[model samples]
Target chain A: MKTLVLVEHGDGKVHDATLATVTAAGKLGSVAALVCGDGEEAAKAAAAAATVAGVDKVLLASGPAYAQMLAENVAALIVPLMDDYDALLCNASSNGKNVAPRVAALLDVMQLSDIISVEGDKTFTRPIYAGNAIATVESSDPKLVITVRGTAFAKAASEGGSAGVENVSGPGDQGLSSFGGCESVKSDRPELTSAKVIVSGGRALKDAETFKEVILPLADKLGAGVGASRAAVDAGYVPNDYQVGQTGKIVAPQVYIAVGISGAIQHLAGMKDSKTIIAINKDEDAPIFQVADIGLVGDLFKIVPELTGKL
Target chain B: MKILVAVKRVIDYNVKPRVKADGTGVDLANVKMSMNPFDEIAVEEAIRLREKGKAAEIVAVSIGPAKAQETLRTALAMGADRAILVETEDEVEPLAVAKILKAIADEEQPGLVLLGKQAISDDSNQTGQMLAALMGRPQGTFANAVEVEGDSVTVKREVDGGLETVKLTLPAVVTTDLRLNEPRYASLPNIMKAKSKPLSAKTPADYGVDTAPRLKTLKVSEPPVRQAGVKVADVDELVAKIKALGIA
Candidate 1:
């Protein structure tokens, strides 16, 4: 079997999620990486990414039409290429979620999202109901399109395989959509989903100003990514991107620190998989303490700063 | 211009779905069913556009059992002009759902299509993009904000990496994200008024779309629960435990 993996890259480097996706795809069959880009930079990134050990070949499409990787044009590029492979793989990133389903629909196949385990040639296990239940599905279709959660699989060894590169031409200028550009931050902090440690805040932080003041110092000291409970996000203490819950980004890092969070079941669905958990809440009965490996009952207003100072 | 919005009857977001002991699927008997929350935002966005004079009509739609008409009525109460229910009993997967919606869009000829990014139940964020693909229209998935002007739409999307924006022609699809807007509740009078609004029904066969599910459910079971670990006495103990776990 041959599996085709979508390659995601930025700043001329491959994303760790793409590497992990390759690892997961390797479990099914030999892998081919499809790197779609709008220019020379995307091509360079593809070349850099193709060296990951498991890839058997790299298919590069760097036409101007791919500028924003618009779901329409990108899915169009992928549909015709599906005839050569048995399965398609992509990280469960927003772009992947946006594109893969279109491909599945056009192929008249059902698309699987955020799959964690490949049970066999056709069966896979995935979480549903905000991680409360796991569902195992088996596809009857001849080909499959799957989006994988990066954290579930280990990254493939990048021991430098010399995979042959193949440039592919696509039907350009689909004219369905145009890119308006991205608003992104090249932050010193790690990306939250892949971060090893996370320090999350809740509504008790009062407001954005206090949230930053209390969460940032401690997070910076531990080099942790910052997260927020749904209540904190709903209270406008942080942007929606900072949300860590069933409706937001699901993370399973090494350590997760919750400050003032009451640990609603939805919040636990997102972070309960973290290897080590810590909680600091004034409410002694807050549900977060039930699963916390290290529970501190106190006021975060004073405790967070003191902990940061000591660290 | 007309805007077509699709809603789904899903298990309420607040409900914790229990897997059946036999492991076939989630037990939905006598469960509280509501319009998918994201679809409420979709209906709300369409109404806001009509209020702004960007849309002259808003048509809400759903595909499920007859009970789904309740979900559509909720959309009507929320301000949609009319609704269509493509009634089906089989479990509809996203691809089939997209096909059914495409058939509706083909007949409605709406300038824009809207839906929730994903239903909380299946959590498969697929229908909007798939409908756009089947119709050969532009798609803006995970939309945070939408602006309609002069036969075109611009959407700010909530992507994994920060935010990105896209501009598309009038005949497009846009999926709602969490931060799109706070959805409005239907007033009592509006609920009664919705009872009178026209809600037409059709079968999947009427649209020439197959309702069979492509994937078979082998089993549905509970995810492994995390066990409670040692609880430290204080911040000092917490820090000490972190050091001992080699997390610091």
Candidate 2:
């Protein structure tokens, strides 16, 4: 079977999640990477993607319309390539979630999303009910389209044998949608998903001011990425990107610190896989403590400053 | 312009779902069911558009068992002019659900189709996009903000690092995210009015769409549990433990 993996990238560099998707694709069959973007940057990304350990070749499809990764245009680009491959795989990232279903629908196939384990070329295991249950699913669709969770697979190494790059023509504009610019949260701290250490806050921080004042110092002291529970994000204490829960990004960092978070099940589903969990809350019986490796019962306003000072 | 909002009934987000012993699926014997939160946001957006005089009618649709009408009633009470329940007892995958919605859209011919980005139950964030593909219409998924104009709609979507905006022609599909307007509670008077509003029922067969599951769920099981560790009395002890572990 031939598998085509979509290489996700930004700022002219391939993302770590794409590497993880490459690893998942390797389990199925011979893997090729599809890098879509505009101009020299797209070629550069294709070069980076070709270095992934398992990729046999790189397909470069560059055009002005591919710049912002619009779903309609991207799906149109992938549809013609479907006949050459048996399965198409992508990281279950934001871009993947946006584009995979369109590709599946255009191909007239069912998509298996957020697969945690690939049992076979046609079977997989995924979480449902917000990770409360794992379901093993088997699909009989002739053409398979799937998105694999990055945390579930190891990142494929970039230092490897050179793979041939093939330049492909754009599928042309679908004329149905157009990209309107992007506003990204500028942060010098590590990215939340790939960060080894993460410091997350909850609604207890009260407002955005208190949240930043208390959380930033601890995160900076530890050189950790900042995260927020749903309550914190809902309260507008931080941007939605900082949210860590079932509905948000999932991470399995080496160390995860929860300050003032009550550990809603949805939030726990996102971070329970962390290697060492720490919870600091005034409430001793908070659900976060149940999953925490080291629990500190105290007021975060007092404990957080002290913790930052010590760090 | 008419607006079509897709709603789904799912297990309440607050309840912890349990895996059955037989590993078929989550045991929903006596669980509280409610409208999916994101769908509520979608419904609210549609209603706001109508209130702003951008839309003429609001039609809410749900695809599920007979009980899903309650979810439709909730949408009706929230301000939908009418409701359509595509009743089905069999398992409906996202693709089939999209196909069913496409058939409904073909008949309704709404200018805008709105839906939640994903249902909390299956977490399959595909229906809206799939429906868009089936109908060959533009889509704006994970929309945090939406602005409707004469011939097009601009949507600010919640993306990976931050926000990305997209512009789609009229008669597009939009899926709501969390940052959309907060849904309003149905007033007592609105609840009584909703009971009298028109509700129509149909089945997947009516659309000639086979509502069979293309994917077979072999088993369902609980995730691995994490055990609780020791409690530290103070920051000093916590720092010591972290130092010992060498993770930080």
Candidate 3:
């Protein structure tokens, strides 16, 4: 079977999730990559994707229409190219979730989303009910569209055999939607998904000011990415992007620190894969303690400061 | 201008579903069901638009079993003018759901179509974009904010990196995100009024859409469980443990 992996990139570099998706695609069969963007930067991204270990070839589709990744045009580009591949794979990122379904609709096939394990060429395992249960599914369609959860697979090597790049023009503009600008949170901290150490808080932190004042110092000391439980995010202690839970971004860091978090099942689903888990909370019976490799029962206000000072 | 809001009846977000012993699917015998949380946000957005005079009417649509009428009634009680239930008993996939909505959109000719970014049950996150592609219309997905003008809609979408703004022509599809708006509760009077609201029911065959399970479930099992570890006495012990683990 031939798998076409969609290579995700930004600022002219391949994303870590794309490398993980490539690893998932490699388990099925021969793997090729499709990198879509505009101008010379897109060509550069395609060249970067060609160096990934599992990829055999890179298909580059560059145009102004592809820049913002409008689903209509992006799906149109992938639909015609689907005839040559048995399966189409992408990272289960925001862009992938937006574009993969449209392609599946155009091809009249069902999409297998957020697959954590590949049982065979056509069978896969995915989390259901907010990650409480895992469902193994098999698709009978002639072609398959799938999105791979990055946390479940290891990243494919970035350097290996040199694969050839082929440039092709994508489908025409749909003229229904246009790019309007993007505003991203400017942060110097490591990204949550790829961070080696993560410091996450919950609603117990009280207010946003206290949340930042208490969490940032410790995170800074450990050189860790900051994350939040859904309760903290809902309480406006942090932005939604910092949410680490079933409804938020799934992460698997080397060390995960849960401070003032109760560890709801939703939150546990996202970070249970971390190598070493530590929890600090005032309550000894907090659900977070159940999963923590090392638990500390104490007031975070005092304990966190002391921990930070000691570090 | 009419606004079509797509609602889905799913297992209540508060309920933790259990897989059957036979490994078929989630047990739904006694579980509570409600309108999907994100779909409630979409309905709220539509009601707000109608109140602002951007929409002349709001129509709530759901594709599920007959019990889905309860979800439509919830939408109606929340201020939708009417409701439509595409009744079906089979497991309808996202592509088929998009096709059914496309048929409804063709007949209703609504100025805007709104839906949740995804349902928590399947979490496919596909129907809205697929419907837009089928109708050859623009799509604004994962929208945290939406502003409808005379001929177009401006949306602020929640993306992985951050917020992205996009503009789409009229008759476009918009999917709601978590932070879009807080949905209001339906008061007692509105609940009484919703009983009188017009709710029409139809089958997938009426729309010439094939609603079938495209994927087969091989097995359902619980994920690996994590065991509780030892507890430390205080910050000193916690730090010692961390240093011993060589993680920090």
Clashing pairs in 1: none
Q: Considering lDDT, which of the candidate structures 2 and 3 is the better prediction for this target? A: 2
lDDT tens string, model 2, A5-112? 999987778898888999899999999999999988998899888777888999999998788788889999999998899999988888999999999999989999
Query: Candidate 3: misplaced stretches above 4 Å?
Result: none
Let me know the DockQ for model 3: 0.78
Instruction: For each candidate in the order shown, give its overall lDDT on alpha carbons.
Output: 0.89, 0.92, 0.91
lDDT of 3 by residue, B21-111 (tens): 8988899998999999999999999999999999999999999999999999999999999999999989898989999999999999999
Best by DockQ: 2
Residue B101 in model 3: lDDT: 97
Tell me how far the alpha carbon of residue A119 in candidate 1 is from the true structure, in angstroms, after superposition. 0.5
Looking at model 3, the pairs that clash are none
Candidates in descending DockQ order: 2, 3, 1
DockQ of each: 0.77, 0.85, 0.78
What's chain A's TM-score in each predicted model?
0.96, 0.98, 0.97
Off by over 4 Å in 2: none
lDDT of 3 by residue, A59-124 (tens): 998999888888878888899998899899988888998899888888888999999999988999
TM-score of each: 0.98, 0.99, 0.98
TM-score per model for chain B alone?
A: 0.99, 0.98, 0.98
Worst 10 residues of 2 chain B by lDDT: B239-248
The CA lDDT at A205 in model 2 is 98
